[model samples]
Target: MILTAFLTAAVLVASGGTATAAAPGTVAASDREVQFVSDGVPAYGTLHVPAHRAGARVPAALLIPGSGPTNRDGDEPPTVTPGTLKLLANALDQDGVATLRFDKYGTGRTGLGGLDPAALDLPTFTRQAVAAEQTLAKQPEVDRDEVSIVGHSEGGLQAMLVARRVRVKSLVLLAPQDLRLLDLLKIQLDAQVTAADQTALSKVITDFRAGRELDYTGMSTQLATFLQQAIFSPVNTRFVRSDDAVYPPSVARPGPRVLLTCGTQDTQVPCWTTSPLAAALRTLPRPLPVDHFQHAPGTRVNDQVLDPSVVTALRTFLEHR
Candidate 1:
């Protein structure tokens, strides 16, 4: 768990007031502040629609952010301000695609809605994604039939789940994780700890699976803190359990066209690791159309700036879809 597309048309929606117009000579997308209620939480986001010939309904995408308290712009501020989603939204706008990017419960203006963050579960976020998709599809300016889900990192996992629940034009997975959640965590943690500490990490996972409280005894402060924040904490327990239960390869089902992208420099979700997902998709009962886009050298998943190759590849994928 780490955390983060386009078209043109009449850009109005019932969830918000009129869409804002782009200034003269600027290739800015028409932006509108939009809202949707998910599980009684009023989620806030921005709808970006590219300027196109009047009366033309363009293809659209629902931008789902990655893990953690990432905002609608795919940033965890004060330190992490990648703005990955925002830049992708702008890129999609240039490609004549509309997008809806929203702040999840714990981030930005959403602010957890008086709910306890410790009690948050994966279903809460899944419901939000589904609701956002519904909202985007219902927009008068979006071609619902041509709508897609462009998910990055953990969002790619969420996108797979969303695709099973709702029909979409395609699935765009950016540096998505292909391994089971806990397994991936083990790999990440192993890289940081000594062989002895790795044993402790394994025990921690075992204790978690056994429904016992994680024992951080004898662990390094750094590893313990990371476990507390990202894994063993009550705040993420429910979500972690739910996420771990999901095997990514199992969800690569037939239905939507799939575009899986990976950056060679992404140490988190390596390009080679995506093979399981691709192989699963290939083995589906029905043949599924899938495209793989490998980024140029030096493109890492955590790039503060969007990689141009990714933008171009994504635009081409959506354009052909």
Candidate 2:
């Protein structure tokens, strides 16, 4: 779902400002929409500090939304359904863990404060984690030492990037592919194309891999537009246009306990099948957390599922671990 659809209101005004609480599908009270500055750009997020929040420092986590222009809530515009991330924040809040989720650059209320959207790039987006961490740590209700991040899809990789710079109590990467963006795009494209178009699309992958333009004749407009989003976007061009897959080495394995997950039916990032990233992760200095919920059937198993299971995993990791 990295392909775009990123939508959401700029949820979260500054602290002590008007506390516009959005209707919680599962809870009630001050889930404040907060804002912070990341590299001179104003960023917005919803800080889910539970109404029942007690103690001087409860464990909290920053939830990083997935690929594309995904908003703070786990979905994009025009049709914001039951949000995957709003559900996640609700789950964590229920477990008494505070959570924060934000809109990336160029999306939501981020660039409206005068920063040119065209100037935003991959680092502009990724470095927001550091800013988010700084902002979240300052909250009186959060235990900064126990703080962690849960990154879904590309955000999972973004979590890895942030981990490279800071130490967290733990990290959770949901449905992340270790393959570079260009390579992963190829896999996604191959899945959606007809057999007859395979050769040409393969050529597209090759050309793209080599830094060549996707100059083709008679290719479907859908494919061309997908190329623009999947490859040529300003942010994507800056970071994801590489052959270097940023998982194995970028992540300091022995540093923090990490949880890696993949949905059985998640075709977008089929890390469950392609590349077998676990094999690489297993040989690291620290063993990745044992893959939870590894059931197949009779247990409400899924050849198909959604991010609700992800909510359970997040709650388990942040609350129990």
Candidate 3:
């Protein structure tokens, strides 16, 4: 189900701590618990301000997590513990940049928030991120005009959506899916099947995307099951249609400074696949230079410890602006 969910639609979607400390190096940062109501759901998150810069306004970012049920920390838990977003927040905090990361409708303390999980869709998630962005900008310690959005994997797509409706100084996409959801899935499924099977899978995807009734004949058991659970299920129908309607390249506008990164070892969104995105960004309104980092080695589907070089690149990119 996890793999099917990722292949079908992709999942997209900080606080402060500390008052006064005796020693300067004793504290990292404070996790200021924050909240915002989105679509009538009270979302929860943390605001992280560096220990040294707790009282001063600082350039900040709203961190959006990837995939399903991921929390503010960027961990899906028990089964996945990359801690990607939390590590990012820590790095940004240490660099004196405040961050806000939250749990979406289905995850963490914000679970469902009394809404039916089946009714969740991308627009609501975008609303949540937008609200978080506004909340971050309003922070006393955050420089509103200097705010940015950093989204990983599916969250990168969400970042683009949020930026369309809000103001952000920059966008950092980490291992984001570069192709449209179905296109990426076609390539992914093609890799595991024969030519005939690929053709059949393509037909199935085409029919589904066109809103035609699906004929699952000739599909492998795995593909049929995946289609049923990930794409055909009523719980996923609305979300898949909404997400598929978006093509990231078309949404890549010329406003904000953009930085895109893809990991060499990341099977989901490989470096080569992001060339289209990189190209789109290069042709932006003013055609400014886009900082593309696609050579981080040893980065996996999830990194328990984020690559130091990647972390450095992110800091340099955000700080450069």
Candidate 3 on 231-260: residue-level lDDT in tens?
668877777777677788878776798887
- 1-321 per-residue lDDT for model 2 (tens digits): 322211221222466522334444423335677877533446778887765423446777888887666778766674543365666677777777788888776557553456554444445455677678667777877888888887776777777777777668888776665666666666777888866456667777677668787765556777767766656666455445432345433453546777777656455666444334555455222222222222232333222223355656666666456
Q: Report the CA-based lDDT of candidate 3 relative to the real structure.
A: 0.72
Report the error of model 3 at residue 50, Å. Answer: 0.7
lDDT of 1 by residue, 34-138 (tens): 877644557788988888666668899999988888899988886777688898888888788899998887788777777776666666677778888988998
The residue ranges of model 2 lying beyond 4 angstroms of the native Cα positions read: 1-13, 16-29, 51-55, 80-82, 116-119, 228-230, 233-236, 239-252, 274-276, 283-308
lDDT of each: 0.74, 0.61, 0.72
Clash count list over all predictions: 7, 7, 13
Overlapping backbone residue pairs in candidate 2 total 7
TM-scores of the candidates are: 0.85, 0.76, 0.85
